[model samples]
Target: MSNLPPLNNETIWDIINDKIDDAMVNQLVWDCLGYSYDNSSQQWDINNVASEWREEYPEPPNFIENRPPTVKLTRSIPPENKQLLKEELGFKGYKVGEFGPRQTRRATVANWLLSYMKQKRETSDR
Candidate 1:
């Protein structure tokens, strides 16, 4: 159990979104799901409460799926310059083409490159 005070569903969600470390939030999620942390699997064991909680509160939408494929970087950086930046950032081929789940820092750079590519296609159509 976490040292933090008991949090309702909304408060748990708020804490999850805030600056707290992800590992801590993961434990909180397990608490909410009524699961006990398992050291071996590095995961929680789903208990009876989890199934009932799911009936009450459906899972939140996946962040990457919910977000736009590209951030709005095009409004600031022109497509040509962005291409040079993308090359410098070293996101090529499949990495450049897909906006998949990745480490936060790398994902931010990838999103910027994707934004530029998106704008290039948009401008080319005109």
Candidate 2:
């Protein structure tokens, strides 16, 4: 059983605010709210959703027009690499057939590796 709290309008707004900058916050807030509404009610109501969002968050930040991505990269881990990663990380109880949970653990391990590498480089440079 997941311990995550149920996501509501305010929680969605707070999540957006935390993950995104002010310029993108309003757009994401509306996007998440609109999606949640449509997902629950099976209907679209962008205008009403926007209105409600505006009422909740008065003086919303200015919308930023889409800009070209600064950089792009593609990455994929092969099965052999995943096996190596599992062995290297000493991951436990992760079944081979499950992708989602394994992928999450792989990402966590990758991040830890990167942080360790960075610290090692910094120490060696000193």
Candidate 3:
């Protein structure tokens, strides 16, 4: 039996969105992470380049499924933590797509769990 929970309903989504990272639901709380609803109505300022960049890049859909990353990581994950997610946590990569995107550091982490979940469910059915 795989450690990963099979994707059904919203289990996988929760894991990707809430389980792994602390997400800020509030928009008014001042912070340099995620979106701030309070700033949504700010007038466009030519001097403040940050205002422009805020709209351009957030958590890009660098992963598979063309799905936006539910976890908005602010920093690079340490190697030890990576090992935990990979070795103990049982994260796997995509079965489809280019090799670099599929196997390299940019490989989809959620896809790892999702693919394994699918495999586990398939074998269990038989």
Candidate 4:
């Protein structure tokens, strides 16, 4: 009875990433699967579409299984101290254990600082 297309992995992923809000994505998926969203369960009841899809396609491999763990930025450094640290890292040659040569270290640090500042400004505008 629904006008929605059949649900598939790619279709679900596209819906989720298509610049829509989470609620809309949930509704679309529910409608496509012919399942009403259940607030009590906080999920759509498994419909025949999902059951059939599961039979046809095994679950996706855990892509993030081997991914590096995310770094948590819980603590903030003072702006002046951060600037001083950047300057020190910029001027000093690479330490004995580091990967790159002295000149490369300065250039790399400078580039990183410039990129960091640019990203900060861009994100603040949002």
Candidate 5:
């Protein structure tokens, strides 16, 4: 016996119509599962989800004319690297002054620089 709730034809159609009606839900469903309404086929299909969505909505229309530009800084090192650096450098909570040894600080800086350089090199090679 399945534990799923009963969904009749009407209920299913209602849900589909609701999704089609709401742009936000439509976009979300498209992004999450790449599901979108098909006008030509006259039925919903996921033949080429990504391509179909892209073709339908080429790009998000400039709804906000003068919206603030988004700025994203990609960190070379992962969060775990930062956490490890803090732990290895002995950064204590409530400590006001320089904590770890100068050598440890130097080593951390060197390691970060090396990793950054390596990432750059790999990207450039590709």
Candidate 6:
């Protein structure tokens, strides 16, 4: 049996600060074994569970009006989007030290904006 505690709104907010939905967390708790959410600690605990099903990053990026990117090149972008960003727009920098998946809140929100901007550009171009 799992030692995961039943999650409440407060606990969920405390964990990810409302970055993802409750149902998703509940489903993860159900599907992933050797993991548990602590109500008091407001965090998830894993016991020797090696899986790509969990991580944490809540620092979202900032944005303003829809404006063309100024930089012509960049290396600070998380590896996944570096190529795509160069093709579509561009990025500034963020000292990630090395290339890897950045599942940060900033990355999450920036991803959404990038998708939205891409779609709009495609639609307008078409």
Number of the top candidate by lDDT? Answer: 1
Give the per-residue lDDT digits (tens) of candidate 1, residues 1-126. Answer: 657444443333333234444344434434533556567987545543445444533432122322321132223345555554335444343435443343332333334434444565688999
lDDT of 3 by residue, 41-108 (tens): 55333232244335654322333332333233212233333343455445454345635422332233
lDDT tens per residue, model 6, 30-80: 332234556788765554333422231121111111111111112223455
- TM-score-superior candidate, 2 or 5: 5
Model 4, position 21, has a per-residue lDDT of 38
Instruction: Point out where model 6 deviates above 4 Å.
Output: 1-83, 97-103
lDDT of 4 by residue, 1-126 (tens): 244434333333333233333334434433433455467877544454455433432322111121111000101223443443246333343457653332332233233333344455678999
TM-score of structure candidate 5:
0.24
Error of 5 at 36 (Å): 48
RMSD of 4: 19.2
> In terms of TM-score, which candidate is stronger, 4 or 5?
5
Per-prediction TM-score: 0.28, 0.23, 0.28, 0.22, 0.24, 0.25
Q: Count the backbone clashes (under 3 Å) in each candidate.
A: 0, 0, 1, 0, 0, 2
* Residue 42 displacement (Å), model 6: 29
What do the candidate models score in CA lDDT, each in turn? 0.41, 0.35, 0.35, 0.36, 0.35, 0.36
lDDT of 3 at 116: 40
* Model 1: ten consecutive residues of lowest lDDT: 61-70
Write the candidate numbers in order of decreasing TM-score. 1, 3, 6, 5, 2, 4
lDDT of 2 by residue, 14-39 (tens): 33224434333333433433422345
RMSD of 6: 14.9
- TM-score, cand. 4: 0.22
